[model samples]
Target: MSTISLTARALLLDMDGTLVNSDAVVERVWRGWAERMGIAPERVFAIMHGRQGYSTMAELLPARPMAENRADNAVLLAQEVADTEGVVPIPGAPAFLTAIERIPHALVTSADTALADARMTAAGLRMPDVRITAESVSASKPDPEGFLKGAAELGVDPADCVVFEDSAAGIAAARAAGMRVVGVGARAASLAPTAFAPTLERVAVTATADGGVRLAVSP
Candidate 1:
């Protein structure tokens, strides 16, 4: 197992590609939206991950008024919640979640509460005790609001939390929140996170002799 230093008292995790496999459902729903809006599906896909639907729609449909974009985004989100069949846990997510439950952990996601719950339930993964959804933050990923809110809800200092993230937005949020970040996907390598592991399955956390925890990434 590979190892890295961690100075945190808690863990903050991102829900989508980091812990669950909802890419198919996300892409499908966004593709439909792209068709309806006459936007490029690939462009929509590129901007939507780790971002709020409203934020994504605003970015994708910049010509549209915010009210119109919000309405369209709500429709798409409703469709996704209604069609949650394809959502599943990422490989080893169950085991990783179980392992971390012994410690304080929170889920910080760009998704709102309803969609976050739907995806978590569909994946058969237990929701974290403390969760900061899009509804809980005025600013989203790459802004640090979500991660900071999550740490606050868990009653931990931002510097006392370790964040597990899969996207550049999330990594930026964690870093801005003064947390150590473990990047958990191929894209992670480019983010220059504190540690980069291919998947959560390859990550391990253990108590250190100094009474803090150490995070390890298995090669």
Candidate 2:
């Protein structure tokens, strides 16, 4: 399937794992948190992807009070933000972003404002003019709140936006928002998207002089 051919006026994107590679840092911090709380790190990691820090902590340590979970998440997230030495833009992220820069694009991340800003700054990617971070929505991914909010912020209907995502939760959000989605990684593709590519580099979007777009996928 071709990504450029999707008829959309705007693009909605997920941050971590989709546009930027921050898995290492995320896993490291979550692992430490799990160890400290006496939970299995691997189990913690499984549910952490595509979720807000507070949400992940709460789910992983349900016995703890919400206040305690929030405090622990804050400490861990701060450490992750402080240690951004290895976080980098995902492969083809620069090119993909450049391709869509001329068009309306909004970041719809599960990350809260602070972590989103920190990750974007670490990757040196240009910040989106419109963004729907964790704080912007009452519900997170798989609920479509973030993507819906992003499309609204861009002044485009949800059906008129294409979402690029790398996790099942993100893909589910996009689908629930009534938008077509292009999965950017293996796991995401398995969830069934409009199309799937190994990376953004394998996908291309071209805008024609007639104000229409063409999406192309390279095998």
Candidate 3:
């Protein structure tokens, strides 16, 4: 086990796997999509996490048109919203969010507004005032556009922000944005996060005298 401490002007967070536990919904939708696309379900699982549905569709069916990908993504979004069966907050997520109540933060997610809203609702999480959804960005994670946009909206420089992320794509996005990242899952460590924790339960937040926030993570 190890501990990490950092101070930042703002926090950029990822939605699905980071804040809300939507593994079941993600797997269910993508598995069905894989079957339809004739790709192996496990293969879809490998590339789909932390990516926009359209991006995943395009990746899975490279020869498909953008229009076709968009249409398929729309269907996936609807299915995800309608089937929020195991969605809930990740461990310690509730208190972690509550502690950061007065801090500047934004949710950067590959999910669209409808799916984001539905999953958050299913998880009993209130959306932060600032959010970047699929509709908010042209490209998805590992592209850095969403994270940079999120920092821009928060009025913080990318270098001064710390991201909390659970997916490989999200961590890569944060790094590409020039922000340090606290990887939020067991697999996160292999991605070279500034710190890795199994769950948010091990994280503690405190406000500094200069108005920045401090994070102490023990894993």
Best by TM-score: 3
Arrange candidates by TM-score, descending.
3, 1, 2
Task: Give every collision pair in model 3.
Answer: none
In model 2, what is the error at residue 125, expressed in angstroms?
1.4
lDDT of 2 by residue, 1-219 (tens): 434446677889999988999988988888888888788998887777887777777776678798887787679878887878779998898888888888888999987778888999999888888888877988767788888888888888888888888887788778888999888876676777887788888888888565545667553
**All-Cα superposition RMSD per candidate:** 2.0, 2.0, 1.0
lDDT score, candidate 3, position 1:
67
lDDT string, candidate 1, 3-38, tens digits: 665656788999998998898999999898889878
Cα lDDT of all candidates, in order? Answer: 0.83, 0.81, 0.89
lDDT of 2 at 58: 73
Off by more than 4 A, model 2: 1-4, 208-212
Local error of candidate 1 at residue 12 (angstroms): 0.6
Who wins the lDDT comparison?
Answer: 3
Model 3 Cα shift for residue 158 (angstroms): 0.5
What's the true lDDT of residue 78 in model 2?
80
Choose 2 or 3, whichever is better by TM-score.
Answer: 3
RMSD of 3: 1.0
Q: Which scores greater on TM-score, model 1 or model 2?
A: 1
Candidate 1 regions with alpha-carbon error over 4 angstroms: 208-212
